[model samples]
Target: MEISRSLAISSWIAMAIVLSIAPAGCFYLPGVAPADFQKKDPLMVKVNKLTSIKTQLPYSYYSLPYCKPTTIIDSAENLGEVLRGDRIENSPYVFEMREPEMCHIVCKITLNEKEVKDLKEKIEDEYRVNMILDNLPLVVPIKRLDQESSTFYQHGFYVGAKDQYSESKDAKYFINNHLSFLVKYHKDVEMDLARIVGFEVKPFSVKHDYEGEWMEGRTRLTTCDPHAKQTVLSSDSPQEVEDKKDIIFTYDIEFQESDVKWASRWDTYLLMNDDQIHWFSIVNSVMIVLFLSGMVAMIMLRTLYRDISKYNQLETQEEAQEETGWKLVHGDVFRPPANSDLLCVYVGTGVQFFGMLLVTMVFAVLGFLSPSNRGGLMTAMLLLWVFMGIFAGYSSSRLYKMFKGSEWKKITLRTAFVFPATVFVIFFVLNALIWRQKSSGAVPFTTMFALVLLWFCISVPLVFVGSYIGFKKPALEDPVKTNKIPRQIPEQAWYMNPIFSILIGGILPFGAVFIELFFILTSIWLNQFYYIFGFLFLVFIILIVTCAEITIVLCYFQLCSEDYLWWWRSYMTSGSSALYLFLYATFYFFTKLEITKPVSGILYFGYMFIASYAFFVLTGTIGFYACFWFTRLIYSSVKID
Candidate 1:
């Protein structure tokens, strides 16, 4: 007995050390970084550029009635030599409209000097020089140009000189002129015909422009066409040609602040200055302290005080009736629970799930499957659930047999499917709703399907095998036999009522998680990102302690009340954590979240219900088994009449 107590104390100390070090190793070690901390390549440069341009561009450019050209010059001398011309090759780009009336257009342009000359020759052959030159003014309909890009152009052009163009609100016209030049000459002109002039025609609100290495080589330009928009008549006399160029052109340009707003000063302040780690650490530490204190209290009361008191009581009772406290209820020791068959099956399945949950959480805390692994936690849990089915079948079958249940086959079949089926139905329904909403946070369809398959194939078979083994083995022999007739029930005090006791058992665990629950709620409902799995692992440990402590404490009182039918009560006492979880979630929805509609509320509670149900089962099993073992150990050692 002394050795067992020493071992338990040592194991608890070791577990505490391990839990502390595990998270420190994963998240806060001096030099070690977790695997999830690995960095990826930076975002593509083109996307960054587009994001910058959008922020800088003026609001007026998004409107219509583009600015008009001052003059049109066609003199060969005014026409600059075809500057550096190159084609922007094909690349993926997305042009989305920010407003209903706006359109976004994106396309690649190829330019060549040789092709422009060929088109000029063809136009010359078709008509006289003077006629062609005169007609050129009216040939390009501005209305047609507007219609061409209207549906495709959502947001206005993302120009560099935003300040210069702020007053005119004509930036879109300048952009359209550039686009028109590219469209007309692109097909007929060779790459050399178009030279990317200085800043006037720059890349627009393009996020990424990986215009390949070859494209970068085309950034060279020689000679300029200051008045390329003008048309000069090729008269027989040079004097006539010189007179035709009467208009002077100015490149009216302006600059404005870039539209892309960098992270706000306040946002940066919030991100870098917030003490998130400290908050989580403090909350987790408090919860752990509370859990440990509660557990220590329960251990003292139940194991230490109860043992001493019971021993004293037994000595006194022997002087009178020669019966022990436990022996007094020996007749009702093995009386079956109400709905014994169903109870056995559910408890058995719950036990299997409980073991799987423990193993999985331990592995997670140990870093085999951390948050960095994305869906690894769920994957591990699913696999363990399937593999642990046998425990469920065996426990359910054995318990049912001990209850003298005759429907072994029925019990086995129900045991195999009941819990899994409930979980599956809940999971599938939630998955369907998640799919409809296209929530990336929800489990994927394939993963859900795989879970179903695992339950039906792996878990069901193992359950059957376990049931067979359980059936083959003799039923567990109870330490005491149940009497055929019930004992006269004694009236319980107000505090001894099952409801009151169950409610009391929930307070400690709820207190441990209420603060943690806020952060969890934020992550789930507000679309916030939270990857503090290390902290969560610690909280899990605290939850276990709180549940066990609460259960043991309540169990002691029930035993003192001489209510020996503590099996389900022990389970439900700790299981009350689920109710607290639900209540906390409800509070989060009303006070912490901005959700307004009934649908969102339903979805929130619906999903929470499933999660809380699982949690209830897990915590209940922990309490039930802990108290069960403690009871068995203490009773086995006592002297009975």
Candidate 2:
């Protein structure tokens, strides 16, 4: 029995190893054939029109191969190296026409025959010519005739650098030889070619820092090109060349005819879009929203109306009867909830998040946050969040005042600090870990400083100003007067219990968004593109409606149960969806991700906690205010004597 168990465990381990590495070798399988395996289609280079421009940020592997400052004075004359959320539509590089054809290779050497021969004798390193087009890396192919392996391509060459991962030295060479890269046509792949649409070199910032400048150029390549320099320029001054500050880059492009259409290049972005599953999610969400809306409408039009009419008529008769149901708790309903100060703080943060989401969606819908621009969406969100601090201050202060809480200063301070402070601390810790790893994705210290500046100089001040304005305004008046003593709560049904109700109430909101959540996770973790903001915006609206309607319905039920402690419960009921989001993230990590490192797992959960908390704030706020308004409207309509 022990031997059999050991064998079974060994087999499982072996299978896990194979599965982990399977994706890397999948392309080499016999079933995976070349593009032109059955039919011959001549390769062509097709140039695409430049859709957007972006600043190039240089990255190095594990902080190896240190970059040097460029001495090219004329380069980067008009370009800004550091990107402070600037659009590059006003770039110096000009692209007139885009077409695909065979490209002609041009090589001009100013070296004498003896010098060239001597240089060739000393050349020991394989020089790789790499191009950046649309911020995408293009590399020269090193051919291998192995039939068992898929065609592997390399983009960069080693220069006296050992393998950081293995700690093993591959090759060593002296940098004493003259180097030149020749443009060559790639004939291995059919129907796929590169056309040099345009090329421009300028001094740009490396790693989002202005401390070091890199003289890098991007050559726009399309899958089609026949060699002709219709508009090409190269700065080949002898002085600049002697300084070794300038590099002359030439490109040869070829195109291959393929069954794949160019229009469908972005088809991957359609993740769940335009599919039956997508429509099903949409239909499911709509049904829930409609059901809740109908419930709310019925209560407002029928039950509440009858209750209010009966209560008013009771007052006109000599034998006046007492009220029951939601009206019985009217006195304590307007009474400030326990810990109103904390609730006010949360309300403020929720308002801020609400504004941030609205502005971000607007910008995304307007195409200002296109995925092609890289980091544009995040940049926009951060900026909008900073500016929307005033909303947080205003909303929190007003709510605190409505609650008759005199600690306006404390409310405003916590509103500004509590959640945002937690987020920033977590971000800093994560960033520190990334920096320790020396990963290129690590946010630089300077960038962190800038963020701090934006927060304090802009967001914080705005919050204060908003708080002042909100405090100066009159406090919100409640429809019913508060009794000196609180009303005794009655026993409730199991369904009306806070824990049970919150658990049940959270499910619908989670259901409304789980499908979309999957696609969003794919985009984030799988590196897939997500550009269908139209559908996203629609889903956002659906989520809002779902939260509001569900919260209102749930609040009504709770009030009907004579539980006036709906302040925190209302918020938690809707915000509980974020708990499910965290659960989904855990499931996704175990099933979808092959992350084997302990550090990665920890980081994943850490960041996920921050995300879940923020989501809780956003959704919880929505439910609270929705219920608040509903309570106010219903109570105000009734005549109390």
Candidate 3:
């Protein structure tokens, strides 16, 4: 026990030292370096090469307006890219709509005999198709030309994938209709670039007056003509273009700029609310913390002090009579919970979760996990979780030993497999559903297999090693020895009822995080950006402190009521926050989300369930350990013969 304590202390000190120095040597802090910020001078668009029906590449064909495909320029990978940043390519097509010569293009398609023969040979052995729609990935990196320094592109949109492309049975209909773009010009003239915000495969049938006649002859692509002066499309002034074989597909252009500045582009959504919600959340959390802290202080400084002093001076019968509340239950306070092994496992897993979060946050604060590097956050989180499995094994084994558990091997195995397996199974089921829907987001079979390998080869082995070390150490010595038979728990007051207490305890923690929760939910569901990790990290610390104080305070009351079964109750008390979280997610969905599709709803809830379950584990573990230490500290303070 002494050796274990020493090792634990040493490890923490070492980690603290490393965390303090590592950030300085590694990445520069956000907003600290002015030279790193540079504007992207000219926005570029690249077209990906052509793909086939056999290949699943999203956009494979290169698109050139008037210039050749070889004119597209690829960009270099830079460090200052935004989260989910794209590699920009110089666009072959450029327009100066303010000129007297309005650009017009009438494209004609001609089949290359040699290339057609090669395509036939490639698809000949497989189930064949005469013609496939050649999709294009127009990579448009949006850089605010106004801002000279901030170059990170936070958002971009793709054009394709509608019923026009998918449902168009004929090849000619698909080509003529699907190749389209929506042009939006602002009324203000300062905005140099017109917003080609979206592309679509609109039915060519919408353009022609003949309802049933399939236009098969020729297609036209054009811009605003110098003579026509066509600019904006409305109900009164609709699009009127020549539909002959060599006619132009007219695109009207105008430019308008708004009040949105480039400096706040990344956080435009957050700027909308003006930090009012964030302040409210912080204030709410502070109030809860103050209330919990006061309650705990009273219990520690006043109530526990009086009881301990009185117990020490128990010389008369009256003095002994006063030792009737929490002091009376000290003998059974350290008693192992029912299903001691499972409880230990939970505690261990919770420790792992805590460690993972701490390390990940530290890295994030150091700027190692930035939006400039795509998937860095998730990748870091996943790796940390896996490597932190040792904590789960060590914590669970130590607690189980303290509980006088003998089945160490069985406990460790279950500790490694149980919770993770449940999560993996749910994930796999959800992935299968996604695969059935043919969603691009589905995890491939190889990736799933790789994940399984990572779990077995890395996480499970770490758990085993940690369990071995933990089990070798002596069990923690309890201040008050357990009695042969368990103490009978007395009935409690209405507020002290487990269900009521658990429900109430959860509300404060949930309230502390609900406002931030809204922003997080918006990022996930509404496709908004979340870059406020510093604030999030602050909230996370507050949450941990709140859970601990609340659980410790409640655990004191429960013990005073002669309810010695605090092992699970302490866990459930704070863990119940997950229930509130899940409920809030449901509320957010119904109130904030306009998801009409049943599949979308199912996907949202299914993932949410997994997330909530993990949260429950993390919070519960924290509460239990806090109360455990609190119980020990108070009991150990009083002299017991």
**What is the Cα-based TM-score of model 2?**
0.66
- Measured on C-alpha atoms, candidate 3 has an lDDT of 0.60
Return the lDDT, model 3, position 285. 88
TM-score of each: 0.56, 0.66, 0.70
Over 1-641, each residue of candidate 1 has an lDDT whose tens digit, in order, gives: 43245334433543443334232322223465321201121110011001111111111111112222233222221000000000111112211111111111222233245433332222222211000110011012122365564221111122222224444433211111121111111111332221111111112221112223323224211111223332212222211001112111112111122222221211211132134753765576576557657666766666656665665465564463644344456567557777777667767877877767677667666655543232345545655666677777777787788888877789988987777778678756755664454332245455556556867877788777777777777877765556899765467789989898987787777777666666766655542334555566667677777777677767766765667788888888888878988888887667765554454455677778888887777777778777776666555655555
In TM-score terms, which candidate is top?
Answer: 3
Q: Quick one: ranking by lDDT, best first? A: 3, 2, 1
Against the reference, the lDDT scores of all candidates come to: 0.49, 0.59, 0.60
Higher-TM-score candidate among 1 and 3?
3
Model 3 lDDT per residue over 128-194, tens place: 1111111112222345589775443222232211233433443121112112232222222463433
Candidate 3 — which pairs collide?
49-60, 49-61, 50-60, 50-61, 83-371, 221-249, 222-249
Order of candidate numbers by TM-score, starting with the best: 3, 2, 1
